[model samples]
Target: MATSSDRHRIRFTVHYDGRSFHGWQVQPDQRTAQGELERVLAKLTNGPCAVIGSGRTDRGVHATGQVAAADVPLRWSPHALRRAMNALLPDDVWVADAEMAPPFFHPRYDATSRSYIYRLGLASEADSPFRAPWCWPLLRPVDLLAMERAAERIVGDHSFKAFAKAGQEERGDRCTVTEARWAPWEGIGLEFHVSANRFLHHMVRYLVGTLVDIGLGQREPEEMDRLLAGEEGLETSPPAPAEGLFLTAVTYPADAGTKPPRRRGPQLVP
Candidate 1:
C-alpha cells in the first residue's frame, strides 16, 4: 500500500450534459458522474480511487463548471491525467481543467461560493427538441420587472427552509446569497444567475418556480420576503424542472492552489 506521502491531490473543473445520468453521486446499478470518473480512474491507477465533488446536482441537472477532487499517483501530471480521463469518460462529460491542489483541499468545504443558472424558454423556437432539453419552455410572457424585484429579495443571508427540499433543516438552512438576478438570454427568454456560499437541496429550483409565478402575476414580489422569513401558511410554488438548471461555477480562496493553465478545450480520441 502506498503511504500517505506518496499521493498527490488533484482538482478538476468538469462539465457534463445531465440528460444521460442519474446525478453526480454514485448509486447502485445506475450511471452517475462520480461513478464514471471513479471507474476510469481506478483503471488508470490499478486500484480504487475516490472522487469528491464540490456538491451534488440532482437528476437532469447539468453542469458547465463543476469542481471535483481526487488523490492520484504522483507520476501522473495534471495535463496527462486530464487527457487520459477525457479519452475514457463518456460522451456527455468533459474535463475542462485540472491541476495540483493543496494536500488537504476539500472541494466542498473549501468552496467560497457556488453559482447556478436557470434558463427559461419563452420563444416558440424554444419548443424545438434541440432546445427543450436544456431550458424550461414556458411559451408565455413574464413580467421581467416583477422577477427582478423578487430576485433582489434573495440577496442576503436567510433561512431558506421554504425553498429547499425537506430533511436538511438540521444542517441549518441559512445561506448567504452574494448575487442574484434575472437577465435576457439571447432573446430566447430570461436566465437567472445566483451565487451563494452554499445551497440546499432543490433550493434554486424552488426559487425559480416561485419567481416564475411572481413574474406571471400569480403572486406579489413581497411573497419572497414572507418566504424568507419562514412564515407559516405559505407554501412555495412547485420546483421548476431539473433540466433547466445548470451548475455554472464554484469559487474558492485565492490560495487554494495554483490555477490550471488555459487550454483550448477538451480533446477526445475518436
Candidate 2:
C-alpha cells in the first residue's frame, strides 16, 4: 500500500485504441486519455494530480507503449495502484503495471527514441474484424516495391520541411530518423515502422500518406529524393488518417528503468 510521503513519482505504460477517443492530451469538454487518467489518479490520491506524457499523440492515434509520469503524495504499491485504477477506470483503459522511479526521472525528457507503426491494408472479404480499427482500409492494390524504395529515401538525418504539416510548432522541420522501413503485413496489408529522436505533429502520417501515393503509382519513388533536397511547392498528397497510427515504443537509458504502471487496453471514463 502507498502511504503519504511514500507516494513518489510513478510512471505508466498506457495503451489505447484511437478510434473512439479524441486524442492523448487533455482538453476541455473532450474525453482524452490524460483526462481520464488524471481523474483516476486524483481519486486514488484523494487530491488533484497531473501526468506528463512522453509526447502528444494526435486525435484518433493509438499507442501501445505510450509513457507518462505522475507524482502522488501517497505511497501506494504498484499492484494496489493497478487494481484500484482498474476498478475505477472504464473498460476502454486499464493499468498494465506500476513501479517506482528516481525523483529526477521524467518520461518525456529522458526518452532516447520513440517508434511508431502505421498499418495500410486493402479492404478484402477475408480481413479480420478485430484489425479494422488499427489498419487503414484501402480499396486499391499498392505497389510494395515502390513503397519500399521511397521509404529508403527517408532514412537518415535531413530537414524534413517538405514532409511536415504546415503550422506545426517546432524550431524547424529537421529530424534524425534512424530507422524507416516498410513491409508486408501477413499478406493482408503494409506496415511502416519508424524510429526517431522526436517527431513533429502529423509527421508520420504525412510521410505515410506520401509513400502510399508512391505505392499507388501516383508519384515516382525518386521524387522522394527531390523532396528531401528541399523541394518547395511540389504538391504532395495529404497525410493519411490518424486512425492507422500507433506509438509502439519508447526507449530510454538503462539506468532510467523505473517502470511505470501498465494498461493493457483502452480505458473509458464516465
List, residue by residue over 76-148, the lDDT tens digit for candidate 1: 9999999999999989999999998876666776689999999999999889899999999999999999999
Write the residue-wise lDDT of candidate 2 on 1-270 in tens digits.
121354576777888777678898999999988888899998988887777788888889988989887777656766677788889887777667777766656677678899999988775832567776677888578888898899998888887877777886455878899999986777777789999988887889989999999988999999988888877778567999897899989988976634432423221111
Per-candidate local distance difference test? 0.89, 0.79
In angstroms, give how far residue 34 of model 1 lies from its true place.
0.5
Residue 187, candidate 1: Cα error in Å is: 1.3
Candidate 1, run of 10 with poorest lDDT: 261-270
RMSD of 2: 5.6
How does each model score on TM-score? 0.93, 0.89
Error of 1 at 170 (Å): 1.6
